[model samples]
Target: MSHTFRRRFAALVLALSLLTLPARALTAQEAGQLLQDYYIDDVSQEVLAQPTIDAMLSALGDHYTTYFTADEYAAFLASMEDVQLTGIGVKMQASENGPVVVEVLAGSPALEAGLQAGDLITAVDGVSTAGLEMGAVSALIQGQEGTQVTITYLRDGVSAACTLTRSSILVAATSAQLLEDHVGLLTCTTFGHDTYAHFTEALDQFPQADRWIVDLRDNGGGLTQAALDTLSVFTGGGIKCYFMDGSAQLSALEAKREQISSAPLIVLTDGGTASASEIFSAGIRDLKAGLVIGGRTYGKGVAQSVLDQYTNPELFDGDAMKITTVRFYTASGSTTDTVGVIPHLLVSPDLAQEVALLLSAAPPSGGTAGYYRLDLNGSWYISQKAALAQPEVFAQLLAAIPPTAALWQGSGDGWNSVQPQQAAADHSIPFQSRLFSDVEGSPYAQSIQRLAVYGVVLGNGQGSYFPKSSLTRAQLAALLAQALNCTVPTGESLFSDVSMDDSYGLAINAIAKMGLVEGVGNGLFRPDDTVTHEQFFTIMGRLAQRVSLTFQISRQGATQEDLDSDRLSRFAPWSRLSVWLLSSSQLDELDQPVSLLWDDVTRIDPTAPISREEAADLLCAVLERTGILPA
Candidate 1:
């Protein structure tokens, strides 16, 4: 028989072999029906020509969504629930010699059989495993409960054998601790079968904490229901999560808020955090139950589901596939796919110190109702204070902030961020006396004029307005505060570089209170430091999100034209800023980052320190795109 035919025949036979009573024999018709009815997207018609339907599923471009053979499918289902594992309870990796045991779980058959870390499995059932893949080795080791499998291995250069009878093992999924100051720290590694149960138990263990720090730092998410159950521990059962094809709701999962902890919540995340982790972090922010810290989260918003094995035994037996059935969203309807939850404040992952510092930094106070605060490290500050529910004195105090300074919002709970519809006037009154001689009649004049009108200019009070001067971090803070309308807070600055009495202190405090920006490095905002194109665009991207003008680029769209730099689509866990910039632009030219004026712009050096005119022009363009100003 031909190779393709042999593969197909084996697949069909395997499918038929796995079926019980009332199950029909496998055929081409069965494969077609399964793919058509359950796949998240259309299956290739070329599936019939391939060796097996598994090949078609593999072409779907998602490695996590694929066909699992009978053995693998059984293991997968067992892991999803509290189903038993019929193995030695040791995790391992394939090596040149054999499989190296990483860890032998305590009380597992492996541990009972005296398996130790660094032990190498040389063979299974007397078959040499030198070149066998780890999965194949695993399959050989696992069997029906009470069955005996002879495991041959090498320990300390010694060869030995152990006949282990497999039994079902329950894998626990979460860990917790009562941190200093009665703060609870709970970390969920995966949203697996036992995660929700373990999480509930962890909460019960640390019931005395005044605040809870949920750590999803390196979690490579699992079950959506697991994410929901965990989040409900904080949100006091409402809508844990839901899916909408478009405007129509497909499913709305409700959970009663268990009121696990009434204290303010904190979540820690990093690049490795994804899927279910992303769901929990986003839901926390959307539901206004907590704040997030650390770097941007991994933006994976798709949901998947495996076909019911019991209901479709003929098709599901010895075969399985996870379909990307729906896109997940936050409770506020925010989609966190390519654009993740940008933490209200970005902090280093050194949890001990960061948690202490965050707790020490008191939130905004003395603000009247209805005003916006400088939030999220100043990456997003309220731009329109008058729109808040506070009194005029509060708005007047915050609105009077120097262009290079910011203040906490004088009103309302400091949760949601606000983007001002109108930029404040006389913001740069500190530099009101300057008259720039370099910017007359230039194409950038119109934008520069409006920027100065709003007091975002970085000019000294002297006769010269040095438009060519490199923009400073302090200047950017003040400008953002003025444009965004962040009100006054007299609290100490979060960064070591600025102080409450310093010239830029209010602005620094203003933005930090709002979680709009963070230190340039090492917890220092570096108020005197110059801004670069990369940093500039990163800031602009956050601003774009605040006004709800952020773009969502499809990965499988019409291929974009090759750009100046080859850095467009290659970004991921490492270079999130690039990804955010490219994905949030409606036009391809934004990636090149050339000036809006097609001409007069030379190389767009992302690392180069930007000039005042350049800053004004770019900010103008962003405002126009966000509809705060005319395009």
Candidate 2:
């Protein structure tokens, strides 16, 4: 409906409901009259037998079709579009005095203005929140962007007022990250206003990756325009969906020409996928651009349009409702309402690891795959040339790879994983440098290079190692965990400050469980905090004990345990070493826990923040002392 028509209709409805009939009482006759005038269902008031509003709606059997009061309507619209309120970024929770700031997002005006979590907002814009609910206070805080909203908050029972300019703050609905085999993993939580733009930017970040994975699992969906815009990224431009409105008027939404990539794609879906996400999945599957994997999606083929009633206060009294007025179908004319689009390949969400493995190793649904490895159980169809051209990675793979690991290639029924014994014979495979470009002349470059090849360290995933930067607690934990080949514990995290879902949780908890490192307190592993030189050395010493390795520079070769032949690094890369603390003469001196306070290596400011190069140098010295590196 046009805006003008909706406004006039709303005014009439409001005026008729309030003035023509006693709406305050909402008698059966008046309710029946309103339903007859505005309800989309076919039931007539004459057939309702003077039924009450609830009875009439119940008889119609359209659960989604209902009435709303002023507050309910406002809440409904807020839930749908979130109202795009301009306010400082702080989520509020109900408190006796007012609303308490439960969270303060980083880089937000609230945080920038020194607002902290747990603050009680007693007033907003000079209006006291003494008798207001959290919702009422939240409404008072919202205003136009660039307008100053003054807030009075109490911390420790001391009140202070601050004025902050409101701005639009949105979390990216789409995120991009590089995964194993250099695949660009892009997951869209929902199609929001800026989701398409964020997705396009994410695609540009991994131009080197040849394949991509689009994870749409658990996405409930969002604006239809966002879905159409996102489809354009993959298809260049195409008819996305056809819509049939209440008046039987049909329209098609075609994507604009702003294609991102045509890479071999794999999509993940689950029961939460609906509406906009369903449209996206249909396009990818129908066009053969990607294979949809995981459980069946949520079927929602109908769209709801707002029934605006803010136009007339006399009739609707500032209340409104929504109706499912449009039915949508995919470009292929497939409508998923009660029956979702069954995946081309049905896979369970719990087997996500296997799905990821297949996408990274198995032949893509259509195109040829480059890198793959067969399991130790002797898989079938073992034939395909490895297309991986990364010399450094290949060399590292050949350095000490397990005997059964093999790379695969080709597509569909022609796929296979092979050991590629011929590639191993090509020793002249130029060793590609993986070090930071600026670290060419740094003395620690070779140390960082070999560690990266061994997968013990990594750059920012954008080719920058930031050699001189301070290593975070998480970074050091990952380094030690990887170096010792520690298997991450699958149980719940031991730290309240970190979650198992985060990248650092497993490594940090693994070392903590091994008694190599202790949390700073309160079950909080501050992963972002800087690692101190003293603390790191102490942890490394404990890791050596946990891993059953003893570093001693007695001018002696590595022991049988340290040089296990089955281990790729069993053979000593160095003949001898002269590290001070590990030297036989000095080893017994700092064996005590308290010795770190006076040890020559860390006697001065033991807790000082350590840089990556310094940490690498220390690691290299340990490696040299333990005969893992050549001197």
Candidate 3:
């Protein structure tokens, strides 16, 4: 047969084959089945029952898994390849006159048009380039490939003009240069198709450097295989990472390559570093191959598999599914999913490289820094400097510790763990316990006494604690203000019903300003209004958000679905998620016997008024759970 005729005949046969594909491969149903089979978490029956693919994916609650249209899939594929830019390629910088060409790329339209370095472009088309920023000039210069652009330039104070067609140019995925003290700074923008080769080439360009810093700041991820291959350059041939599938089965990804360099390594990351970038960082850290110095990375430990018509002709027509198949972990088996890879020395993103360079040269000296080593879920050595520098981070680490757990202190490798009470006793610290006579035999006695000691709850002047009385809105505000360290308002109250002379006025205004509460419509503070159980939980949830307090939801605790379908639904729409969060959190147990419905994670009377005793217990439980009040 003739070649053209054969090609047409082959296309016809393929079209016919697609028309006769099996019925089992139809759209939503088959895609749902595939999702259930491949998803990294258990797919609920409710999710699969959705009639359309979009609804199904949304119900699955896995944000990474997505459906992409044909055009979107094409763009995604292009992004995974080498970075491409379309322009009459010439690198330029801003100058007093106009953009001054620094270099003309070989094989580019600019070079072909005879544009040279030191030539300043005075205008584009007929528009003046004066006072336009470099970015503005670049936007004007870059356009659709094959489009024509005219530039007016001054060569040694003489005017000239050139018309050029824009074309696609491939930019290097990685670049490297040597810094002072034999330090190499290698920057990688993407884990694209050519990342491994480009990374190696960059490394090879600076082989004389003894220390290296791989900057992965603002790098979102690309191809997984490319990241693994690039990481192998440092770790050599071995198991680089582990992945856990839906069935909890673990698999290791190994690379069979020899180590490229044995020099000390440092990784720089920021909040934008995700997925493949995180994989590279985790591998280096887990292998003890490098020290990461930057803000916490964007936690994206899941891996996705793209399914398109090319991969499965029978299942897909033009649309595709980017399904999350597994959760990847470091070689040490820890995943950077929600909690990102913590840097060895955390610093601001701009300062991270500077700090890394300093540490690369020599260890930090000349500080009365003490280290607090704690073994919560993992081993961590927190320095006094780190704690003071990032107090919120230090508080979070401390919160991870069980309240009664001992903390260790010492310098370098020598350490001694000291219990809270023991350390206090050894230092002869004066510890006082407050007693309330009225609550001496009550179930909430201990909680009331504890809150009294923390100054969160008070008695009726004569030492008579009214534990069973209903908690008032004003009372609750004062209690929260004290616990949260909210400053007492100095100005006039915002509510018409409240006055500066009122006892709870300052606390009410302070919390209101902080958005913890709202006036009972029409400027009424309603200080005497009863605080309900649901309202209290909602406030606790809001408090958690205000402080950025993240909780580890207990698997055994109630889920949001359960709360929505149960009596808890009586809560306001804005309060449900918060109430669920508080109910599901693994909070410290209360000393007293008063049964708060939230403690059971079920059977809460949402509209019932909360009592003083229950309010105190709940508040104290939150404080202890967040490490605000020691056990």
Candidate 4:
């Protein structure tokens, strides 16, 4: 049998096995044991000691780890495939008194029965839904096909009751259409069991299209295998993701099928794009198969292993647990866990598809008569006319795009490429200035601008640099990582207070791995605490040491009286050495102390917090002293 057929057959068999499995009751202890054995992290005995399975799972604080009863398991399994469930079909959310109807699907029984959005469902078959969970309310509404359900709802202060027959409704997991310019647009709402097949069907309908856009915005992920299979259709066989469990070993998830189309692919993403959706996005990017354009994706890098009676007949009868078993990474060993996959082109989610379409346009044949071809980081063919239509967004993109972005201009096959600024001046497109609006007057302005051009430092969104603010631990780590071009680690952090979810956790881990930083105590890296002058100097000293530079002054260079001065004594014994090193070290050509304290002075105060400007000066000084940065 074909690999695709084998995969589908396996999925079908798994679903069928779930239905035929014996309904046996599982003890809470068994559930806890299963979780302890297979969960991504080791569980403490205290957490597992919770009286019930639900309590144990909840205490872990892993929202993805869930225990499902037989009926719930059936629904869970069904949700992984195309939607075909017996329901009245009104999407609802829990409210104070009952569930509020949010949406009514077209041709659904609820819509036919005159239910509308904003209607509060008070009861289901005379049973009050007040304060019930959404799952409970849904369970009360869905039943066997042809079964009748009575729903009591309030519409604008008036109560009404309706009895409707539930029917099977099919919601397509994937939708396809040929868009303007022959670009095939495939929107996948989920990575379901049949999603790969649906994608292939979509591709078959648009064989003539040379470019395709896969829109994954707001697509909460589903089956991992489904996502891999669908990605295979575009990228052919390769490693889709890397999985690391409690074992701490990276394992590759390979796509085994040949590609269906060699057309240039573009992926659209948003903050709501997660999990299997992320898997597909990362695969497209890492495999060099497509370009991702949109907002940062929802960072969901962990995969859950669903265990049930069908798989472990001896342990579970009907109930099952979906436990987080591993953290997944990109094929390049980078993670989309807390640090989501940042798009190559970051546009508003609403405009992502439009921008992608613009990017997919071929370079003009007649050589740019009405159009100007632009290239940003190898992604090309954005036209000036189309860009000018969305001036505000184009300005935003121009700001984000590097200053090195090239532009082509001419007429009738005589196009000439020019610098971005030159092209912007010629075409009247606004460009971002390298200097911050507020930093031109700061003492460290020159250093900050240099770093900014190198992409080491960035201004706050409003274009101002908060130079007076004290630098926090997290911010320091991020700056150091960027300045050094450190490869941020994707594994679990060593510090207890930092998780993969923390914005700067990856940077912290990266610096920690380089032995330039450490936790304060008790395995806690106080990421929010401000960095003191002494602490900053110590880290700089470590950095200098790593690069084989010696900043420490010998006895001949500094007298015993100078070494024992109160200024040096104020610092901690362990920090005094680094402080002295920094105070004595001079810039190569300038012959000035590397340490820049308050008010641009060389004096060091061990206890005082370092301001943002001071930190920038200090970093530049260190880099210059060590020959890492041009003096």
Q: Pick the candidate with the highest lDDT.
A: 4
Better of 2 and 3 by TM-score: 3
Decide which is better by TM-score, 1 or 3.
3
Candidate 2 ranges beyond 4 A from true positions: 1-41, 44-56, 66-178, 204-210, 246-249, 310-318, 352-354, 361-631
Go through the candidates in order and give the clash count of each.
43, 5, 0, 0
Q: For model 3, how does the per-residue alpha-carbon lDDT over 1-631 read when each residue is reduced to its tens digit?
A: 1233222222211111133433333478987887766676778899999999888988886778988765566676666565579999787878777799966765899999999989999999878899999999999999999999999999998999999999997755666667774788887878877888876786778777877889999888887777888888888988887666565556678877778987778889888899999889878876777767676778787877766665556676655677787677766555565446666544567667665554454222453236555443233344555454543444333322333334776545566776433433443444222346688666766677666644455567566778888989998888777666554769778999998789999989988987878888999989999998888888876665443223322323546575676645667776776676666443335632332233564556778899887887777666544433433
Better of 3 and 4 by lDDT: 4
TM-score of each: 0.46, 0.40, 0.49, 0.63
List the candidate numbers ranked by lDDT, top first.
4, 3, 2, 1
lDDT of 1 by residue, 1-631 (tens): 1233222322112112455545333444665565565444556677644555566555554555556666676666555444456887887877778799966765788899999879999998998889898889989988888888898999998999998989887655566666554667676677765777776787677677666778788787877777887788777778866554322324566666475665677788877888888888877876767667665667676666564454454455456555555566666545565446655444445442244223422233564453345432222223343223223322233332222323443346444423221222323211222224567755676576555533445456443456677888888888777555445577556887788788778987886665656786787888888887667666766665543323322222323443223544332222344333433334544464333321222345667797877777777766544333311
**Which sections of candidate 3 miss by over 4 Å?**
1-26, 88-138, 144-168, 178-182, 357-631
lDDT (Cα atoms) of all candidates against the true structure: 0.59, 0.60, 0.69, 0.73
RMSD of candidate 1 to the truth, in angstroms, is: 19.2
Best by TM-score: 4
Residues 292-331 of candidate 4: C-alpha lDDT, one tens digit per residue: 8887788777878776655666766667777787787766
- Candidate 2, backbone clash total: 5
Residue 441 error for model 2, in Å?
A: 70
Residue pairs in candidate 2 whose N, alpha carbon or C atoms collide under 3 angstroms: 14-314, 14-315, 14-316, 15-315, 574-630
Per-residue lDDT over 13-99 for candidate 2, one digit per residue giving the tens place of the 0 to 100 score: 211122344333334565555545444344564546746666766766565566666557656434423234467878777866778
RMSD per model, one decimal: 19.2, 25.5, 15.1, 11.9
